[model samples]
Target chain A: DTAVSQTPKYLVTQMGNDKSIKCEQNLGHDTMYWYKQDSKKFLKIMFSYNNKELIINETVPNRFSPKSPDKAHLNLHINSLELGDSAVYFCASSADRGDGYTFGSGTRLTVV
Target chain B: AQSVSQHNHHVILSEAASLELGCNYSYGGTVNLFWYVQYPGQHLQLLLKYFSGDPLVKGIKGFEAEFIKSKFSFNLRKPSVQWSDTAEYFCAVSPWANNLFFGTGTRLTVIP
Candidate 1:
């Protein structure tokens, strides 16, 4: 069974469009996170949630938002996508922040 | 300043060769460290972790890492690397319970 899974493995959208990526985990973890991997393979934290409670924002722009409906699911919503928003977004979950994480395959978002 | 630093951006090794990847972090107070690996077109996987107790920790695929608190380093190493071991390696730190910080990543190319 997949520990962590993400939907819409590939997404191509135009600028000024809105998009959302969904993530789920079956590991019974309490914490979920959204991360962006750039073209240079630099991973940056976008948001973090624990038990459906927002924990950290990571100084990301207001255009990007994350919502957690439950402890097992965390979704990312991007508004007015820009060219710079084109990157691979990864979803991950862990029992807690101090524990190692299990990551999803990632969603490749392309904005033109 | 980067929270985590992976100085070796790329490393190449032949089959059966020993491997080592450097990782350092700039953080104070108690922290949890981890090493994650991502194969081509795959999601990231936890290779090892350090959360206290023994400074040396072992994970899947015969990978191991040592945490040196004095130097703020957690270096991943494998005595013999197979071609299938080629992947991107990332070092991460959780300084607090709210978020995780990842390194820039190191691409390891293992030759047959």
Candidate 2:
């Protein structure tokens, strides 16, 4: 069984468009996170939610918002997608803040 | 702010060769360290983790890492690598919270 899973493995959209990526975890983890991997393979944390509560918000632009309706789901919505927004976004979950995370197969977002 | 650094951007090796990837973090207090691998077209998966205890941690696929607190380093080592081992390896650290700070990954290409 897949512990962490993300929907729409690939997303291609034009500039000025909006898109959303859905993620879910079945590991009974309390924390979920969104990470962006740039073209150079530099992965950085964008947001983190613990039990549906916002915990860590990195220096990401407001155009990107993460919503966690419940402990099992954390979704990412990007508004006014730009060319620079084209990168792989990964969703991850962990039992707690200090535990190792289980990552979902990333969603490759391409903005034209 | 805590940060993780991976020195090698890309590494090339032949089958049966030994491998070592360097990872360093800047944190003084208690921390959790992890190594994750993403094979071609696959999701990220944890290889090994070091929370506390015997600094030397063994992981799947004949991989191991030693956490040296004095130097703030967690280096991954494999005595022998196969062509199937070619993948991108990432080093991450969690210092205070659940959010993990990841290093710019190291891509390993093992030629058979």
Candidate 3:
């Protein structure tokens, strides 16, 4: 079984539009995260949820929001998408603070 | 002000050549270190991680990393690299948080 999975592997939308990316993990981990990979391939942590509770929130724009319905599902919603939002979004999960880090395939978003 | 640093932005090596990637973090308290590889069109895979005990940690695909507390560094090493090993390597550091702080990453190109 796939440990972590993401929906819409590729997404292309125009500016000012809104989109959502769904993520699910079956690793039975308590913590889930959303990370962004820029063109330079630099990974940046966006948000983290522990047992459906918001634990880590980085200095991201207000347009981006993360929702965790449960420990196994975490979704990202972006409003007013801009060209700068064109990047690969990755979903990851860990057993704890830094144990058993597993990542999803990623969803590529292109805002034109 | 916690950050991870990967000095080698890009590296090129031939098949069967030894490989080493430098990773450093600037954090005061105890931290966990990790090495992750992202292959072409694939998700991030954990290479190795260092939480405690045995500074030397071995991971999958014959990859290993050593954590040096004094230097606040966790460097990854491999005796011999193959062409399939070409990927982007990222070093992450977590300090009592639910998320990970990733480095800029190093692109490794192993020529066959």
Fraction of true contacts retained by every candidate, in order, equals 0.83, 0.85, 0.80
Tens digit per residue, CA lDDT, model 1, A7-42: 999999999999999999999988999999999999
Docking class of 1: medium
Clashes of each: 0, 0, 0
Give candidate 1 regions above 4 Å deviation.
Answer: none
lDDT at B87, model 2: 98
Error of 3 at B47 (Å): 0.7
Residue-level lDDT of model 1, residues B1-112, one tens digit each, is: 6489999999999999999999999999899998988899888888888889999998889999999989989999999999999999999998887578999999999999
**Winner on DockQ (1 vs 2):** 2
Error of 3 at B54 (Å): 0.9
What are the per-residue Cα lDDT tens digits for candidate 2 across A1-112? Answer: 8889998999999999999999999999999999999888889899999978898998999999999999999999999999999999999988775777889999999999
Q: How high is the DockQ of candidate 3?
A: 0.77
Q: Candidate 3, which segments miss by more than 4 Å at Cα? A: none
Query: Per-residue lDDT for B73-109 in model 3, tens only?
Result: 9999999999999999999988875768899999999
lDDT of each: 0.91, 0.93, 0.93
